[model samples]
Target: MKETAQKYKRQTASRYLPVGAQEITSKIMEAESYGVSTKHDGHFYLLSYDGKKATLTNHGGRVIDDLPLLKEATALLKGKCKTVVLAGELYLHKEGGRTRSFDMTAALDDKSTNIYFAAFDLLSLDGEQVSLDIKALDQKLNTVLSSGKSLHAVKNSFVESRKDIAALYKEIVEDDGQEGIVVRSHNGPTYKIKPLITLDAVILGYAEGQGSRAGMLKEVLVGLCVAKDEYILLTKVGNGYSEEERKNLLKELGKKKVDSGYIEVSGSNVAFTMVAPNQVVEFSCLDVFGENSKGVISKMCLSYKDGTYTANGKQPMASVISPVYVKMRTDKKPDTNDAGLSQITKIISLDINASEKLDVKKSEIVSREVYVKISKGAKMVRKFMVWKTNKEATGEYPAYVYHYTDFSAGRSEMLKKEIKVSDSKKQIEEIFAAEVLENVKKGWEKVKS
Candidate 1:
């Protein structure tokens, strides 16, 4: 079951609109027919009925057996001759009003009753694998799964030209308030068509690379300037950089390194090297959400001056989805107008949490430790500190932070640091212990705090 779930995760599609809608339309005109469907903002899960029971598993291989809708699915699929597997989205479907992706996220977190499953693909039927075309898959799904109160087929249609696609986009995305639409080519690649939201942001830092990209740029951290020297943490862009661009951009950004008082890490677990906010870059995203999938507010404000970046407070900001690096804007300065926060706010209405506030208090240091190691008359120093941000009530900053700083005068990049934030004391203790075990070597002597 795990292998099956891994083999066919959600089908990711390439974007077509905002950049090359016409070029994509020209390419699609060559194909015979394409299947287009409204893209629902929801979580992807695989539903399976193996004769005796129906199991619903997410992309992470964790089975969600407690969903009340599972009982209805089991009742409908038990009569099938073989084990049936279907791929669909679990979304919030209100009977009378419009529901967005964030609503679905909140619903899932609170176990809301409005959640519904919209089946899109038919992976298996009668215990046999199905490799049908787009139209055939739609037909098979309609024939296999009946529309119930908790389950229904996703809205889809067939298109052979650009006009059809544009009409669907106008009706579904622009008029109907959907996030976007997905079109599957008859026998070729699939494309996701959505109006791209563009923003000019300042480059804040870059996370170190890994694997094949070692010593190169893995991700670029960006921010929106809300005022003359104030910025908000926007997102960590990891895509749209060519292999050559990665090496070249990294070298260019290396000269602007600064000792920013805050730390941010990438999904790959590499620490970011802070840089001066002097460069303006363009980025495009499909959409932005104020809350993450886990129902946590995702907003952080910062103050920058004199080659230093400090956290100001947690304010209202949107977390971008699939942020793609466009280019470096050499003509524009990294100021409020060029990299303004209103660029995003004017386009989409951010769902601001009532509890979110800009109430940042002074961070209190709970513990401090310093260690010294001298070799060949060169002194190397390590400092570890544990502090409470006191802004945890805002749901933006972590309750506790474990910071490790290393300064070696012998190295080219003389100073390196790592920061770990958590809400649990046990986890912080484990992190502090791990750092001590690894860095406190034979020559290192502890200094009184």
Candidate 2:
């Protein structure tokens, strides 16, 4: 009787969380598939739906102020399935509002943009919510997805062929929507946030703004791409292009404003009145939210900011891009370097937690040996291999890596418990040489835990 009473109280408390931050609890989630999801309440944290009443402060409002997720949320919820503890974005998707989606619905205050819950992972399901068993959670999630509810949950995928999907990506981009693709692992219930390496997008036109906006022409077109053809519209931007670039674009685009005003571009169902697709801008962006039929791309940037405007390089203010300006890029076709590893890395950074997405088997100091052009007049030391990719030799992948400058004394302790430090007697003697040498080697540390 005491255990039963305590259970009831605990369940009731699960309805509310402290305001500012939230943490994953020990709740065991059974097997269940997660659709890309969005949290409806702006709150970064939430109370589990206990089928009682709204316990969260905003019961119906958001505390986290998250934009819509770029991917759709889905899951099959019936049958003799295991209890699933799902983790994902919880959002409100107004019912019966196909065209409006999250952005339009929220902004327009359309009641139709009802709340929605899209889980991306199965933390636990069917009487098992493992606190640390990610693999178990993943498997359970897949089991639930097999129930067949995903076909209608949100964005649907029916594989045809890789060639077909690639072609479709170009059509969506031509439509002036988001730019990229989502390749699901047929081997498992996993979806990767991928960037286009050779995709196409329609040309909408350049933005009309100032200062950094001065001169040579650039663009700001409403764009889209594919799944088989994933096309999503990007967001509001007043920065990016320079004034000179804008001017060049105006002069060139003026000639394209046709009698019909409907300028045909690349990618999906996208069209621009004044801007034409004569010139393709190479770049990258972040994938945000998506509707059943549309997708979203945010934080887009030109790979090359120095290149001349293809539109009107000869017109007034047709300033040539400075070489130092690091020709954002211009060597290959716009589609050649579509979204690739670089793109996927960026997207993964945003959607998945560091611990969840990255391989955490062993953490350690990462080192790489590359020759920097030092002053020829200065003494140089023999170079040695510090870090190397096993990919080239062992056919294995490399880890996501970064470096930091350390000038501070041992203000912070070096690598701690769970990881050890080693040095040969001769190596330690060598490291004891000059203070400058010790300083450099001392700073070169790693994280192993």
Candidate 3:
């Protein structure tokens, strides 16, 4: 189950576009034949049945063996096939409220919460990959799955024209309360169409409100990390929080105030009080744009140091559209891998460098040391090199590279190496000292090259 989860995680997530964007949706609707399925607001999981036993694994590699849904699936498929795997959303239904991801998360620990799985795709059957079309796959699921409360097939509709696609979107998304619709082509690309999109970013600053909301925060400035301690200003979110929440956030951010160097306003003439980048927040927006309507890059990158933010003259990757505050993610941190540009690029296709390509300086080697130590008639060599990556100006590369290599003629592997990157000269120097102290012992002799 862990191996299968890792394999699926490597596959690119399906691309998506705004449902109202006729320019993009029109092209997708032109596919020869397609099927539409409701985009459930739930967690993604895979169900694998091996004729005798069944297992369920979430995208994050957690195995769920105790859900009643798993037991039901195993019994239904006992004599049907040797093995089968299906992919779908794991959601919990509410009696009078709409299905939401947050609600599902809150009920995960409640054994009596009635968890359910909506199988959408037939990935494999009888231990062989299934390459059937959407219609064929739907038929197979109907025949094999039969009906059950805890486990069932996701409902779908087949369409051939733009008119039909638009109608389905209206019915499923706007009227039926589903988050969105996913349309899969018979021979082309698959698309996820939605009215709004969500993003996770780090808080950079805040602005005070006025008039009726004068005592609270009016809006919060947010950015996405492009590198270590470097963030690209994305957007300001003002709506979707209560008055009490606004007041609490203002008091919380006041202690983190810092000096602003590049940005000054929220694009609306309101002055900003900059703060440290420490909080990870989730926000919903209508869309994200790499360029403004005037075809100009509208985002800027900044570097933070010693409680200050300064402009870093590098091309920005993106900016948000009409963002609204949602919730704080205490489990996440403001780092490159968590709050990075790849988070946005993974969901939607954007030409971030459409205006102009950026130029970067080549890396310069600053120091090199090679040492040899002879032990018991065998020779072992160690090498250390340090280089400055002036490419940080491009907002795409780290500031320095510390590379270490070790080779031994007597070992089966013969070679072992490690490469580390950093944005601080002092930190890199300390790393160099530590490496030398650990590897350079009594019999080692420095060699000039």
User: Could you tell me how far off, in angstroms, the CA of residue 155 lies in candidate 2 after the best superposition?
Assistant: 2.5
Clash-forming residue pairs, model 1: none
lDDT of 2 by residue, 355-404 (tens): 11212233343443322222334322222222222222211122222222
lDDT of 3 by residue, 110-153 (tens): 74446778888777899898877888888888777886667888
Model 2: worst 10 consecutive residues (lDDT sum): 312-321
The lDDT for every candidate, in the order shown, is 0.75, 0.29, 0.74
Number of clashing residue pairs in every model?
0, 105, 0
Q: Which candidate tops TM-score?
A: 1
Question: Candidate 1, residues 105-161: lDDT per residue as tens digits?
Answer: 457667666788888877778777889888888887877776566876776799888
RMSD of 2: 21.7
Q: Pick the candidate with the highest lDDT.
A: 1
Error of 3 at 420 (Å): 20
In what order do the candidates fall by lDDT, top score first?
Answer: 1, 3, 2
Error of 2 at 129 (Å): 6.8
CA error at residue 136 for candidate 1, angstroms? 20
**Candidate 1 at 300: error in angstroms?**
2.4
